[model samples]
Target: MSKSITITNEDILQEIKLSCKTPEIVEQIVSRKVIISAAKEAGIEVETEELQKAADLFRLINKLTSAEETWAWLEKHSLSLDDFEAIVYSSVIFGKLSQHLFTDKIEPYFFENQLDYAGVVMYEVVLNDEDLAIELFYAVKEGEMSFSDVAHKYIQDTELRRKGGYLGIVRRQDLKPEISAAVFAVTPPQLLKPIVTSKGLHLIFVEEIIQPELDNKLRNQILTNLFDEWIKQQIQPVEFVKLFELGS
Candidate 1:
Protein backbone atom coordinates (compact mmCIF):
# COMPACT_ATOMS: atom_id res chain seq x y z
CA MET A 1 0.00 0.00 0.00
CA SER A 2 3.05 2.28 0.23
CA LYS A 3 4.37 4.22 -2.72
CA SER A 4 7.95 3.57 -3.81
CA ILE A 5 10.43 4.96 -6.32
CA THR A 6 13.15 2.83 -7.84
CA ILE A 7 16.53 4.15 -9.03
CA THR A 8 17.18 1.56 -11.72
CA ASN A 9 18.34 3.94 -14.48
CA GLU A 10 21.12 6.48 -15.03
CA ASP A 11 18.58 9.36 -14.99
CA ILE A 12 17.97 9.05 -11.24
CA LEU A 13 21.70 8.78 -10.61
CA GLN A 14 22.41 11.86 -12.73
CA GLU A 15 19.80 13.89 -10.82
CA ILE A 16 21.35 12.81 -7.52
CA LYS A 17 24.82 13.79 -8.76
CA LEU A 18 23.62 17.35 -9.41
CA SER A 19 22.13 17.71 -5.92
CA CYS A 20 23.84 19.75 -3.16
CA LYS A 21 24.19 16.67 -0.96
CA THR A 22 25.86 14.49 -3.62
CA PRO A 23 29.44 15.39 -2.61
CA GLU A 24 28.69 14.76 1.07
CA ILE A 25 27.04 11.40 0.30
CA VAL A 26 29.99 10.40 -1.86
CA GLU A 27 32.43 11.37 0.94
CA GLN A 28 30.51 9.27 3.45
CA ILE A 29 30.49 6.24 1.16
CA VAL A 30 34.19 6.56 0.35
CA SER A 31 35.16 6.99 4.00
CA ARG A 32 33.06 3.98 5.01
CA LYS A 33 34.64 1.85 2.29
CA VAL A 34 38.08 2.91 3.52
CA ILE A 35 37.16 1.94 7.07
CA ILE A 36 35.80 -1.45 5.98
CA SER A 37 38.98 -2.11 4.00
CA ALA A 38 41.21 -1.15 6.94
CA ALA A 39 39.11 -3.30 9.27
CA LYS A 40 39.51 -6.29 6.96
CA GLU A 41 43.27 -5.70 6.63
CA ALA A 42 43.58 -5.58 10.42
CA GLY A 43 41.67 -8.92 10.67
CA ILE A 44 38.82 -7.34 12.65
CA GLU A 45 36.23 -9.45 10.91
CA VAL A 46 32.63 -9.60 12.16
CA GLU A 47 31.76 -13.04 13.41
CA THR A 48 28.55 -14.97 12.57
CA GLU A 49 27.39 -14.67 16.18
CA GLU A 50 27.82 -10.90 16.09
CA LEU A 51 25.91 -10.66 12.82
CA GLN A 52 23.04 -12.75 14.21
CA LYS A 53 22.93 -10.69 17.40
CA ALA A 54 22.90 -7.44 15.37
CA ALA A 55 20.11 -8.74 13.13
CA ASP A 56 18.10 -9.83 16.19
CA LEU A 57 18.51 -6.41 17.77
CA PHE A 58 17.43 -4.79 14.50
CA ARG A 59 14.30 -6.97 14.30
CA LEU A 60 13.45 -6.31 17.96
CA ILE A 61 13.85 -2.56 17.55
CA ASN A 62 11.61 -2.54 14.49
CA LYS A 63 8.99 -4.75 16.22
CA LEU A 64 9.28 -7.44 13.55
CA THR A 65 8.29 -10.34 15.80
CA SER A 66 7.58 -12.86 13.03
CA ALA A 67 9.97 -14.04 10.29
CA GLU A 68 7.32 -13.10 7.72
CA GLU A 69 7.20 -9.52 9.08
CA THR A 70 10.98 -9.30 8.97
CA TRP A 71 11.06 -10.50 5.37
CA ALA A 72 8.35 -8.03 4.44
CA TRP A 73 10.24 -5.20 6.05
CA LEU A 74 13.39 -6.15 4.16
CA GLU A 75 11.41 -6.34 0.92
CA LYS A 76 9.95 -2.89 1.53
CA HIS A 77 13.47 -1.50 1.87
CA SER A 78 14.58 -3.33 -1.31
CA LEU A 79 17.06 -5.34 0.70
CA SER A 80 17.65 -9.09 0.93
CA LEU A 81 18.32 -10.89 4.25
CA ASP A 82 21.90 -11.44 3.11
CA ASP A 83 22.26 -7.76 2.29
CA PHE A 84 21.00 -6.77 5.77
CA GLU A 85 23.39 -9.22 7.42
CA ALA A 86 26.30 -7.93 5.34
CA ILE A 87 25.50 -4.35 6.31
CA VAL A 88 25.38 -5.29 9.99
CA TYR A 89 28.66 -7.19 9.68
CA SER A 90 30.35 -4.19 8.07
CA SER A 91 29.04 -1.94 10.91
CA VAL A 92 30.50 -4.30 13.52
CA ILE A 93 33.85 -4.27 11.72
CA PHE A 94 33.84 -0.48 11.56
CA GLY A 95 32.98 -0.09 15.26
CA LYS A 96 35.65 -2.58 16.33
CA LEU A 97 38.27 -0.93 14.13
CA SER A 98 37.38 2.51 15.52
CA GLN A 99 37.56 1.27 19.11
CA HIS A 100 40.83 -0.56 18.54
CA LEU A 101 42.49 2.47 16.96
CA PHE A 102 41.29 5.22 19.32
CA THR A 103 40.49 3.71 22.72
CA ASP A 104 43.61 5.15 24.35
CA LYS A 105 43.15 8.71 23.02
CA ILE A 106 39.60 9.24 24.32
CA GLU A 107 40.56 10.34 27.85
CA PRO A 108 43.33 12.69 26.69
CA TYR A 109 41.08 14.18 24.00
CA PHE A 110 38.27 14.65 26.55
CA PHE A 111 40.56 16.47 28.97
CA GLU A 112 41.93 18.77 26.27
CA ASN A 113 38.54 19.72 24.75
CA GLN A 114 36.20 19.32 27.69
CA LEU A 115 34.37 22.56 27.03
CA ASP A 116 33.16 21.40 23.60
CA TYR A 117 31.09 18.58 25.18
CA ALA A 118 29.64 20.63 28.05
CA GLY A 119 25.90 21.15 27.60
CA VAL A 120 23.98 24.37 28.10
CA VAL A 121 20.25 24.82 28.59
CA MET A 122 19.26 28.08 26.91
CA TYR A 123 16.08 30.10 26.41
CA GLU A 124 16.25 32.01 23.14
CA VAL A 125 14.06 34.38 21.19
CA VAL A 126 15.11 34.80 17.56
CA LEU A 127 13.86 37.69 15.45
CA ASN A 128 14.42 38.77 11.90
CA ASP A 129 14.37 42.48 12.80
CA GLU A 130 17.38 43.72 14.79
CA ASP A 131 15.50 46.75 16.11
CA LEU A 132 12.85 44.56 17.74
CA ALA A 133 15.60 42.31 19.16
CA ILE A 134 17.39 45.19 20.86
CA GLU A 135 14.10 46.52 22.22
CA LEU A 136 13.23 43.13 23.71
CA PHE A 137 16.74 42.80 25.19
CA TYR A 138 16.48 46.19 26.87
CA ALA A 139 13.01 45.37 28.13
CA VAL A 140 14.25 42.14 29.77
CA LYS A 141 17.33 43.93 31.24
CA GLU A 142 15.15 46.73 32.66
CA GLY A 143 12.95 44.11 34.46
CA GLU A 144 9.96 45.41 32.54
CA MET A 145 9.03 41.89 31.32
CA SER A 146 10.05 38.28 31.84
CA PHE A 147 12.20 36.64 29.09
CA SER A 148 9.95 33.54 29.07
CA ASP A 149 6.81 35.68 28.82
CA VAL A 150 8.38 37.64 25.94
CA ALA A 151 9.48 34.44 24.22
CA HIS A 152 6.03 32.86 24.55
CA LYS A 153 4.35 35.93 23.06
CA TYR A 154 6.84 36.98 20.33
CA ILE A 155 8.99 34.02 19.30
CA GLN A 156 8.33 33.17 15.64
CA ASP A 157 8.76 29.39 15.78
CA THR A 158 5.62 27.61 16.93
CA GLU A 159 7.39 24.70 18.64
CA LEU A 160 9.91 26.96 20.39
CA ARG A 161 7.20 29.41 21.40
CA ARG A 162 5.26 26.56 23.00
CA LYS A 163 8.29 25.80 25.18
CA GLY A 164 8.87 29.49 26.01
CA GLY A 165 11.77 29.44 23.51
CA TYR A 166 13.75 26.89 25.50
CA LEU A 167 16.52 25.43 23.27
CA GLY A 168 17.08 22.49 25.64
CA ILE A 169 20.47 20.96 26.60
CA VAL A 170 22.98 21.26 23.74
CA ARG A 171 26.74 20.84 23.40
CA ARG A 172 28.75 24.07 23.14
CA GLN A 173 30.14 23.09 19.72
CA ASP A 174 26.63 22.33 18.48
CA LEU A 175 25.96 26.07 18.56
CA LYS A 176 26.94 28.40 15.72
CA PRO A 177 30.34 30.12 16.02
CA GLU A 178 28.84 33.56 16.55
CA ILE A 179 26.51 32.34 19.28
CA SER A 180 28.79 29.71 20.88
CA ALA A 181 31.34 32.16 22.31
CA ALA A 182 28.62 34.39 23.77
CA VAL A 183 26.70 31.48 25.29
CA PHE A 184 29.78 29.84 26.82
CA ALA A 185 31.21 33.16 28.04
CA VAL A 186 28.43 33.85 30.55
CA THR A 187 27.35 32.01 33.70
CA PRO A 188 23.82 30.81 34.27
CA PRO A 189 20.93 33.28 34.63
CA GLN A 190 22.70 35.72 32.33
CA LEU A 191 21.09 37.32 29.28
CA LEU A 192 23.06 37.85 26.07
CA LYS A 193 22.46 40.93 23.92
CA PRO A 194 21.26 40.55 20.36
CA ILE A 195 23.65 38.17 18.56
CA VAL A 196 23.25 38.13 14.80
CA THR A 197 23.91 35.12 12.61
CA SER A 198 22.93 34.17 9.07
CA LYS A 199 19.64 32.83 10.38
CA GLY A 200 18.59 35.92 12.39
CA LEU A 201 19.18 37.87 15.61
CA HIS A 202 19.01 35.71 18.75
CA LEU A 203 18.55 36.90 22.36
CA ILE A 204 19.74 34.11 24.56
CA PHE A 205 19.17 33.48 28.28
CA VAL A 206 21.32 30.80 29.88
CA GLU A 207 19.33 28.61 32.28
CA GLU A 208 21.90 26.00 33.28
CA ILE A 209 25.35 24.73 32.30
CA ILE A 210 26.08 21.00 32.48
CA GLN A 211 29.82 20.37 32.76
CA PRO A 212 31.33 17.47 30.83
CA GLU A 213 32.74 14.40 32.65
CA LEU A 214 34.69 11.55 31.07
CA ASP A 215 31.94 8.95 31.52
CA ASN A 216 31.65 5.84 29.34
CA LYS A 217 29.10 7.45 27.03
CA LEU A 218 31.10 10.67 26.74
CA ARG A 219 34.31 8.72 26.16
CA ASN A 220 32.68 6.67 23.42
CA GLN A 221 31.31 9.85 21.82
CA ILE A 222 34.75 11.50 21.79
CA LEU A 223 36.28 8.39 20.26
CA THR A 224 33.59 8.29 17.60
CA ASN A 225 34.17 11.96 16.78
CA LEU A 226 37.90 11.40 16.51
CA PHE A 227 37.32 8.36 14.30
CA ASP A 228 35.04 10.38 12.06
CA GLU A 229 37.67 13.12 11.74
CA TRP A 230 40.28 10.49 10.90
CA ILE A 231 38.01 9.01 8.28
CA LYS A 232 37.40 12.43 6.75
CA GLN A 233 41.13 13.10 6.57
CA GLN A 234 41.73 9.69 4.97
CA ILE A 235 39.40 10.53 2.09
CA GLN A 236 39.92 14.30 1.77
CA PRO A 237 42.67 14.05 -0.85
CA VAL A 238 40.83 11.67 -3.19
CA GLU A 239 39.04 13.31 -6.12
CA PHE A 240 35.80 11.86 -7.48
CA VAL A 241 35.30 11.71 -11.24
CA LYS A 242 31.89 13.00 -12.22
CA LEU A 243 31.18 10.66 -15.10
CA PHE A 244 27.52 11.65 -15.25
CA GLU A 245 28.17 15.41 -15.23
CA LEU A 246 29.78 15.18 -18.68
CA GLY A 247 27.42 16.41 -21.45
CA SER A 248 24.36 16.22 -19.22
Candidate 2:
Protein backbone atom coordinates (compact mmCIF):
# COMPACT_ATOMS: atom_id res chain seq x y z
CA MET A 1 0.00 0.00 0.00
CA SER A 2 1.13 3.58 -0.79
CA LYS A 3 1.36 6.11 2.02
CA SER A 4 -0.74 9.30 1.90
CA ILE A 5 0.81 12.69 2.80
CA THR A 6 -0.98 15.61 4.49
CA ILE A 7 -0.51 19.37 4.14
CA THR A 8 -0.74 21.16 7.52
CA ASN A 9 0.41 24.75 6.84
CA GLU A 10 -1.39 26.71 4.07
CA ASP A 11 0.66 29.76 4.99
CA ILE A 12 3.92 27.97 3.99
CA LEU A 13 2.66 27.55 0.43
CA GLN A 14 1.51 31.19 0.32
CA GLU A 15 4.83 32.44 1.76
CA ILE A 16 6.80 30.34 -0.74
CA LYS A 17 4.72 31.72 -3.61
CA LEU A 18 5.22 35.29 -2.42
CA SER A 19 8.94 34.91 -1.60
CA CYS A 20 9.80 33.10 -4.82
CA LYS A 21 8.36 33.30 -8.31
CA THR A 22 7.04 29.76 -8.69
CA PRO A 23 4.44 28.04 -6.45
CA GLU A 24 6.93 25.20 -5.87
CA ILE A 25 7.64 24.87 -2.14
CA VAL A 26 9.78 21.72 -2.53
CA GLU A 27 12.17 23.43 -4.97
CA GLN A 28 12.66 26.33 -2.56
CA ILE A 29 13.26 23.98 0.36
CA VAL A 30 15.67 21.84 -1.68
CA SER A 31 17.64 24.84 -2.91
CA ARG A 32 18.02 26.22 0.61
CA LYS A 33 18.99 22.78 1.91
CA VAL A 34 21.62 22.40 -0.82
CA ILE A 35 23.17 25.76 0.03
CA ILE A 36 23.21 24.97 3.76
CA SER A 37 24.70 21.53 3.10
CA ALA A 38 27.39 22.93 0.81
CA ALA A 39 28.27 25.54 3.41
CA LYS A 40 28.62 22.84 6.05
CA GLU A 41 30.68 20.59 3.75
CA ALA A 42 33.07 23.47 3.14
CA GLY A 43 33.48 23.74 6.95
CA ILE A 44 32.21 27.30 6.77
CA GLU A 45 31.58 28.13 10.39
CA VAL A 46 30.53 31.62 11.52
CA GLU A 47 31.76 32.44 15.01
CA THR A 48 29.76 34.81 17.25
CA GLU A 49 32.62 37.33 17.22
CA GLU A 50 32.89 37.11 13.41
CA LEU A 51 29.14 37.64 13.03
CA GLN A 52 29.25 40.70 15.30
CA LYS A 53 32.28 42.00 13.39
CA ALA A 54 30.46 41.48 10.09
CA ALA A 55 27.37 43.26 11.42
CA ASP A 56 29.54 46.17 12.59
CA LEU A 57 31.42 46.28 9.28
CA PHE A 58 28.17 46.20 7.34
CA ARG A 59 26.81 49.12 9.40
CA LEU A 60 29.99 51.13 8.87
CA ILE A 61 30.20 50.34 5.15
CA ASN A 62 26.60 51.27 4.46
CA LYS A 63 26.61 54.16 6.98
CA LEU A 64 23.78 52.68 9.01
CA THR A 65 23.18 53.78 12.60
CA SER A 66 22.86 50.42 14.37
CA ALA A 67 22.93 46.62 13.89
CA GLU A 68 19.12 46.58 14.07
CA GLU A 69 19.07 49.09 11.23
CA THR A 70 21.47 46.84 9.31
CA TRP A 71 19.07 43.94 9.83
CA ALA A 72 16.24 46.11 8.58
CA TRP A 73 18.32 47.07 5.56
CA LEU A 74 18.97 43.41 4.78
CA GLU A 75 15.26 42.65 5.15
CA LYS A 76 14.54 45.52 2.79
CA HIS A 77 16.81 43.78 0.26
CA SER A 78 14.80 40.52 0.82
CA LEU A 79 17.47 38.99 2.99
CA SER A 80 17.34 37.83 6.63
CA LEU A 81 20.07 38.44 9.20
CA ASP A 82 20.77 34.67 9.27
CA ASP A 83 21.07 34.65 5.47
CA PHE A 84 23.54 37.54 5.65
CA GLU A 85 25.67 35.69 8.20
CA ALA A 86 25.61 32.54 6.06
CA ILE A 87 26.76 34.55 3.04
CA VAL A 88 29.62 36.02 5.01
CA TYR A 89 30.66 32.58 6.23
CA SER A 90 30.46 31.20 2.68
CA SER A 91 32.59 34.04 1.39
CA VAL A 92 35.29 33.38 3.97
CA ILE A 93 35.27 29.67 3.10
CA PHE A 94 35.53 30.45 -0.61
CA GLY A 95 38.44 32.81 -0.01
CA LYS A 96 40.29 30.17 1.96
CA LEU A 97 39.50 27.55 -0.68
CA SER A 98 40.85 29.83 -3.41
CA GLN A 99 44.09 30.42 -1.54
CA HIS A 100 44.53 26.70 -0.80
CA LEU A 101 43.79 25.52 -4.36
CA PHE A 102 45.36 28.09 -6.67
CA THR A 103 47.88 30.37 -4.93
CA ASP A 104 50.91 28.51 -6.30
CA LYS A 105 49.60 28.28 -9.88
CA ILE A 106 48.36 31.89 -10.00
CA GLU A 107 51.61 33.45 -8.77
CA PRO A 108 53.70 32.04 -11.64
CA TYR A 109 51.04 32.79 -14.26
CA PHE A 110 50.76 36.45 -13.18
CA PHE A 111 54.54 36.94 -13.11
CA GLU A 112 55.00 35.52 -16.63
CA ASN A 113 52.34 37.82 -18.12
CA GLN A 114 54.02 41.00 -16.72
CA LEU A 115 50.78 42.96 -17.19
CA ASP A 116 51.22 46.77 -17.27
CA TYR A 117 48.75 47.37 -14.43
CA ALA A 118 48.49 51.01 -13.34
CA GLY A 119 46.27 53.70 -11.82
CA VAL A 120 44.31 56.00 -14.16
CA VAL A 121 42.48 59.25 -13.41
CA MET A 122 40.07 60.37 -16.12
CA TYR A 123 37.10 62.66 -16.85
CA GLU A 124 34.16 61.64 -19.04
CA VAL A 125 31.68 63.89 -20.87
CA VAL A 126 28.65 61.86 -21.89
CA LEU A 127 26.06 63.78 -23.84
CA ASN A 128 23.14 62.34 -25.76
CA ASP A 129 23.38 65.36 -28.02
CA GLU A 130 26.19 64.72 -30.52
CA ASP A 131 26.72 68.40 -31.27
CA LEU A 132 27.17 69.20 -27.59
CA ALA A 133 29.64 66.32 -27.24
CA ILE A 134 31.75 67.55 -30.15
CA GLU A 135 31.60 71.11 -28.82
CA LEU A 136 32.73 70.06 -25.36
CA PHE A 137 35.50 67.90 -26.85
CA TYR A 138 37.01 70.86 -28.64
CA ALA A 139 36.58 73.07 -25.60
CA VAL A 140 38.59 70.60 -23.54
CA LYS A 141 41.29 70.00 -26.19
CA GLU A 142 41.85 73.68 -26.69
CA GLY A 143 43.06 75.82 -23.74
CA GLU A 144 39.60 77.43 -23.59
CA MET A 145 38.52 75.40 -20.53
CA SER A 146 39.94 72.50 -18.47
CA PHE A 147 38.41 68.99 -18.57
CA SER A 148 37.42 69.21 -14.90
CA ASP A 149 35.91 72.66 -15.41
CA VAL A 150 33.83 71.52 -18.42
CA ALA A 151 32.87 68.23 -16.70
CA HIS A 152 31.54 70.19 -13.74
CA LYS A 153 29.59 72.44 -16.09
CA TYR A 154 28.16 69.90 -18.57
CA ILE A 155 28.49 66.25 -17.39
CA GLN A 156 25.18 64.54 -16.58
CA ASP A 157 26.39 61.76 -14.30
CA THR A 158 26.03 63.30 -10.83
CA GLU A 159 28.64 61.03 -9.22
CA LEU A 160 31.34 61.82 -11.76
CA ARG A 161 30.36 65.50 -11.99
CA ARG A 162 30.87 66.02 -8.26
CA LYS A 163 34.39 64.54 -8.40
CA GLY A 164 35.27 66.76 -11.41
CA GLY A 165 35.13 63.67 -13.65
CA TYR A 166 37.97 62.08 -11.77
CA LEU A 167 37.71 58.32 -12.37
CA GLY A 168 40.04 56.74 -9.85
CA ILE A 169 42.69 54.11 -10.63
CA VAL A 170 41.19 51.50 -12.94
CA ARG A 171 42.86 48.36 -14.22
CA ARG A 172 43.50 47.90 -17.96
CA GLN A 173 40.93 45.08 -18.02
CA ASP A 174 38.32 47.38 -16.44
CA LEU A 175 38.47 49.79 -19.41
CA LYS A 176 37.20 49.16 -22.94
CA PRO A 177 39.74 48.04 -25.52
CA GLU A 178 39.67 51.31 -27.41
CA ILE A 179 40.03 53.37 -24.21
CA SER A 180 42.73 51.08 -22.83
CA ALA A 181 44.68 51.18 -26.12
CA ALA A 182 44.58 54.98 -26.15
CA VAL A 183 45.45 55.27 -22.47
CA PHE A 184 48.51 52.98 -22.73
CA ALA A 185 49.68 54.79 -25.93
CA VAL A 186 50.17 58.04 -24.03
CA THR A 187 52.85 58.97 -21.44
CA PRO A 188 51.98 60.14 -17.92
CA PRO A 189 50.32 63.58 -17.42
CA GLN A 190 49.27 63.38 -21.12
CA LEU A 191 45.72 64.25 -22.10
CA LEU A 192 43.82 61.90 -24.40
CA LYS A 193 41.62 63.79 -26.86
CA PRO A 194 37.94 62.98 -26.65
CA ILE A 195 37.09 59.48 -27.82
CA VAL A 196 33.50 58.43 -28.48
CA THR A 197 32.19 55.26 -26.90
CA SER A 198 28.60 53.94 -26.84
CA LYS A 199 27.91 56.14 -23.81
CA GLY A 200 29.40 59.37 -25.14
CA LEU A 201 32.68 61.23 -25.59
CA HIS A 202 35.30 60.60 -22.90
CA LEU A 203 38.30 62.83 -22.32
CA ILE A 204 40.90 60.86 -20.38
CA PHE A 205 43.88 62.16 -18.46
CA VAL A 206 46.65 59.81 -17.34
CA GLU A 207 47.26 61.29 -13.91
CA GLU A 208 49.62 58.64 -12.52
CA ILE A 209 50.72 55.16 -13.58
CA ILE A 210 52.09 52.80 -10.95
CA GLN A 211 54.16 50.03 -12.50
CA PRO A 212 53.02 46.47 -11.72
CA GLU A 213 54.54 44.90 -8.63
CA LEU A 214 54.73 41.16 -7.95
CA ASP A 215 53.26 41.67 -4.53
CA ASN A 216 51.01 39.60 -2.22
CA LYS A 217 48.01 41.63 -3.41
CA LEU A 218 48.47 40.56 -7.05
CA ARG A 219 48.90 36.93 -5.96
CA ASN A 220 45.64 37.09 -3.95
CA GLN A 221 43.79 38.58 -6.94
CA ILE A 222 45.03 35.85 -9.29
CA LEU A 223 44.06 33.19 -6.76
CA THR A 224 40.60 34.73 -6.51
CA ASN A 225 40.09 34.48 -10.28
CA LEU A 226 41.22 30.86 -10.34
CA PHE A 227 39.01 29.99 -7.37
CA ASP A 228 36.02 31.65 -9.02
CA GLU A 229 36.57 29.48 -12.07
CA TRP A 230 36.81 26.40 -9.86
CA ILE A 231 33.57 27.23 -8.03
CA LYS A 232 31.74 27.68 -11.33
CA GLN A 233 32.95 24.25 -12.43
CA GLN A 234 31.75 22.69 -9.15
CA ILE A 235 28.22 24.13 -9.39
CA GLN A 236 27.65 23.56 -13.10
CA PRO A 237 26.36 19.97 -12.86
CA VAL A 238 23.78 20.53 -10.08
CA GLU A 239 20.25 19.32 -10.93
CA PHE A 240 17.03 20.34 -9.16
CA VAL A 241 13.74 18.41 -9.04
CA LYS A 242 10.60 20.52 -8.77
CA LEU A 243 7.94 19.57 -6.15
CA PHE A 244 5.19 19.19 -8.75
CA GLU A 245 7.36 16.70 -10.58
CA LEU A 246 7.67 14.57 -7.42
CA GLY A 247 3.84 14.32 -7.20
CA SER A 248 3.68 13.32 -10.84
Count of steric clashes across candidates, in order: 0, 0
Q: What is the C-alpha lDDT of each candidate?
A: 0.86, 0.68
TM-score of each: 0.81, 0.63
- Model 1 C-alpha RMSD to native: 4.0
User: Highest lDDT among the candidates is held by which one?
Assistant: 1
* lDDT (tens digit, per residue) of candidate 2 on 43-97: 7665777666766675677898976787788878778767887766655555555
Q: What is the C-alpha RMSD of each candidate to the true structure, in Å?
A: 4.0, 7.9
Output the TM-score of candidate 2. 0.63
Best by TM-score: 1
Task: Candidate 2: give the clashing pairs.
Answer: none
Candidate 2 runs further than 4 Å off? 1-92, 112-116, 129-131, 214-218, 243-248
